[model samples]
Target: MSATTYDRLVEIVTKLHDAPEDRISPDVTFAQLDVDSLTMVEISMRIERELDVHIDDNELEADLTLDATTKLIDAKLAA
Candidate 1:
């Protein structure tokens, strides 16, 4: 949606992958980033801490792309 969300997702993805921000994209999958289950959990925890939001397991499982994850986070923030 917003560039801010996209930027944040890129930042998080970059942090997780240790890649340049430009390398991360909305279409990229978590698996493609070489992120494992434990890493995903860690990412979730970081997101919760940074964004002040709670993400359910189901939601985490369902969001497969960076864009989707950003959307989910946006929706939760809206709620």
Candidate 2:
């Protein structure tokens, strides 16, 4: 998954949380990582800036899992 959306998402979360990517499997939720509201906002912005995708801020209100975010990013890219 190198250079893929999934890998990017995992790398982002792992970087923020200082956790190993493998410890942050696809199904792991942001809540599990103690992600705060502010951090979510930061993440949202980073994803948009880094991926050049206009992800709605509301996306963070839904499932904030790496896998889910990857899917969202991929779908947006496909569109």
Give RMSD to native, each candidate: 2.9, 2.0
lDDT at residue 2 of model 1 (Cα atoms): 48
Question: Which runs in model 1 stand beyond 4 Å of their true positions?
Answer: 1-3, 20-22
Cα lDDT of model 2 by residue, 1-79, tens digit: 3498887777666665666555678888888777887878877887888889877777775357778888889999999
Q: What is the lDDT of residue 30 in candidate 1?
A: 78
RMSD of 1: 2.9
Minimum summed lDDT over a 10-residue window in model 1 is located at: 14-23
Maximum-TM-score candidate: 2
Model 1, range 1-79, lDDT digits (tens) per residue? 5458767767765676575555567887777767778778877877788778888766675238888898889998899
Superposed by TM-score, candidate 1 places the C-alpha of residue 74 at a distance from the truth, in angstroms, of 0.5
The runs of at least 3 residues in candidate 2 whose Cα sits more than 4 Å from the true structure, single-residue gaps closed, are 20-22
Per-residue lDDT of 4 in model 1 = 84
**Model 1 residue 13 CA deviation in Å:** 2.5
TM-score for candidate 2: 0.83
| Candidate 2, position 68, lDDT | 81
TM-score against native, each model: 0.80, 0.83
lDDT (0-100) at residue 68 of candidate 1?
89
